[model samples]
Target chain A: MGDYVFNQRHLLGLADYSAADIRHVLEQTRTFREILERPVPKVPTLRDKTIVNLFYENSTRTRISFELAQRRMGADVVNFSAATSSTKKGESLKDTIRNIGSMKIDMVVVRHESPGAAHFLTKCVPAAIINAGDGAHEHPTQALLDMYSLLVHFGRIEGLRVSIIGDITHSRVVRSNIIGLTKLGAKVTVCGPKTMMPPFVEELGVRVTYDLDEALRDCDAAMALRIQMERQDGALFPSLREYHERFGIRMRHLEQYPDFVILHPGPINRGVELQSEVADHPRALILDQVTNGLAVRMAVLYLLSGGSRV
Target chain B: MPSRLLHADDFDRTIRRFAQQFTEPYDDLSPLAIIGMQTRGVYIAKRIRDRIREFRGVEVPLGVLDITFYRDDFRSLDKVPTAKITEIPFDLDGLDIILVDDVLYTGRTVRAAMEALMSFGRPHRLRFCCMVDRGHRELPISADFVGITVPTYTTERVQVRLAELDGEDGVVVTEGA
Candidate 1:
């Protein structure tokens, strides 16, 4: 109705946020920003709201950021570790969510190692489902923050050239960022090894590339995708060294374009997809991305809750 | 709510007067160095910057800071969170920083903004400017430049809307819960 609600039960994916919706979220983020700046920063925006952080995957930044965002907005936050939950005891994902929903949770922020785990949980609970990270599928909030970071840097998203490098097949950040960036009118290029890069990525209306140098050229921003070793077992690439040599972004590689800004969704492997020098460089917005993660998540919660209020 | 109203010209003149009071001492301050706290502060800062440029042909740099994570009351609230973007193209180190806002009620927002601003860099001087300074100082803070001083009770809320953001320009005082 209101260009799709950023509500209590939002499923985390770029598909969930339309261009207008994204704009609305970003615009609403401004108000949340102001609220955050108050000495007594907690807003009663979600006074009685309860958010269940059902993380099946281990994440330091994502979980903590979401927790902080919720607390900042005046919502009650509950952290559910899947390792100790019924899932470890062989209970179904649906039953777990159902049992939790019975507790009257207003929303669920889920991060699972399996693809579409958040989607699965959505079916089991009426609570607003937000995908933190579901396997290799989508991390919508990560993409939103990335887009927010980029928009803040560039002033506008329309007609900008963005290159996403690394494990396109396994990186959920890539999938979400590609969808979100393209939707906001930015031209995106996915570059990595042929094995790691997804097939028919052009179907998403993005240019596919095996050459990192070619992809890096003339690009306004280059986002290096993290190579999840746990996900790769001789299927994607021959060796990590080979991937680093050809596709990895190093200081030498960055010398080709002095104006390009670099981005990486963290837990970065020093020499795998990106060099430490490039990651730590002033042009790198990786750490800023981490700081922005909290704010953007707060924005998501605010807009979703505010929409529900209307 | 007594239906308080001020004409657009009066608002513009107040802004002009506030701008004069705020910028008078910093005649040599580069226009490219001002930063605004986010939301309404940004709108007020933009107006001051534009008016300064229009009158003196000196365009100043403006940026917005989002202090969501830096606030003290974060843990007492909701867990489903949203974040805003913090955009400052240039460094604020040793530069004059004029933190702008629409209404100064309890001074808590300014305090949080100051905390957030410190993370970027220490400024040469930090000043506070506000559209309305409603008397209810929860902290020992006073605006360097104020457009108006309206005595308000604790149950009253002040709302400011700009044409650039809210499709209109006006201020409203409502009864708070």
Candidate 2:
């Protein structure tokens, strides 16, 4: 297994990848993680390739992380924002991508409001497509990075209990994590308010619960997802204060579960999803998630570009 | 058909000779370190280090480097180059680094190794050591400590099998069409 190559061409979701394929990516990510610690922190592996960051939705961490990873690998990057692009003039998705496709782009990192927006690009363009976040469908890179951070902290993921708490109904992170963690032999539990919890979450091979305390009771790590206020149309919970009082991860929870670590997928609500003190605690892996996200994205882009070219 | 160039005994003698060459130049082996390229080079480096410790009464730091990320031909490859552990535990600021590899062909691996080493820190000096220097120079790079220099066609294959990895210690050349 010295030359374990990632066989997938596109990273649309974690469901498309096998357990060995996911492990291969996580193992390769260790190299990129070390590269970031080097004196130069750059490589020319992707110098000849040109990648386009096509964002049809608003984002901060994922966008910057992908761009940094691309630049660090010495790839030429083109940024496409939906608000400023031809999509604003009512141009269709296929037509806009086809226009950009003429420029000979090698890959496209896309985040759109509609689910399966990334999968749509593969049929229209020859470039490999990486789904940053497509509505509430799946964010493979974020989940992969989350798993990477978990592996880094605990040294293994198999047979570990993980609790994912927050807006499960509208969280792409939870969906991807459940699929990825389960494939790697992890037992996952999803905890959120009944309104926020998806109807068919148990079908994805994770235990569902409405109580945050029960979720974090016997787990190795707890991932607190952002509430995603923008994605929620009607109020999932009654109020932000009530939600914080009910399900927010506070310092007491840390004291209660001393053996478990905390994780959040960025833009943490100060008092809603996580207490300010808990977010700044030593056990919190939010910052590490950001760092690992870059490495994971770099690994994904490198593997996808190297994917079985005929 | 493949023809054997060096059997197990010959391989041991060549490694001991390389260890002697490494120790003869320096008054003190304190500043010297050995960095082995991924798989085969790692075992050869370990043998040389063991020999130096047994005869010269000095221990040298050994580091492992995987140059998959630093390769120049990533786009041209049929599959993604896999990576191994690159662990340089000691500081590389002023160490005299000797890069060890099993075979030297186009010298592209050496080029990538040199670049990869510089990323850690500025070493005092860097040199290359290889068991087999098969002549095909795509880059202007050559091994300083060579076991055997063989003149061969670009289509030929030079195989180095170590007992640690391949269950045998031998060097063989196979004809290619």
lDDT (Cα, tens digit) per residue for candidate 1, span A1-310: 3334444347568887778778766666665555555445565556667889998889889999999999986799999987777788898777888888989887889998888788787678767778899998999999988888898899998899999998888888988888888988999998988888677889999999889889998899999888887888676777788889999999997787888999888889999988878889999999878877887888777655532311
DockQ of each model against the real complex? 0.10, 0.63
Off by over 4 Å in 2: A1-5, A307-310
Label model 2 with its docking quality class. medium
Q: What is the DockQ score of candidate 2, to 2 decimals?
A: 0.63
Q: Report the C-alpha lDDT of model 1 over B1-177, residue by residue, as the tens digit.
A: 444544567777877886676567665757336667667788878888888887767877888876655555544545433456677766778788888888898788888788777766678888888888889998989998877788878888877767788776767678888
Please list all clashing residue pairs in model 2, or write none if there are none.
none
Tens digits of per-residue lDDT for model 2, A1-310: 6555467889999999999999999998998998898877898888888999999899988999999999999999999999898888999989989999999889999999899999999999999999999998999999999999999998999998999998888999888999999999999999989998778779989999888889989999999988887988997889999999999999999998898999999888899999999999999988999999999998998888884342
Query: What are the candidates' interface root-mean-square deviations?
Result: 9.5, 2.0
The model with the greatest DockQ is: 2
Model 2, A156: alpha-carbon shift in Å? 1.6
Task: Report how far residue A41 has shifted in candidate 2, in Å.
Answer: 0.9
lDDT (Cα, tens digit) per residue for candidate 2, span B1-177: 898998999999999999999989888999999999898899899999999999989889999988988898776687777777788878899888999999999999999999888878999999999999989799999889999888888888899998877899989999987
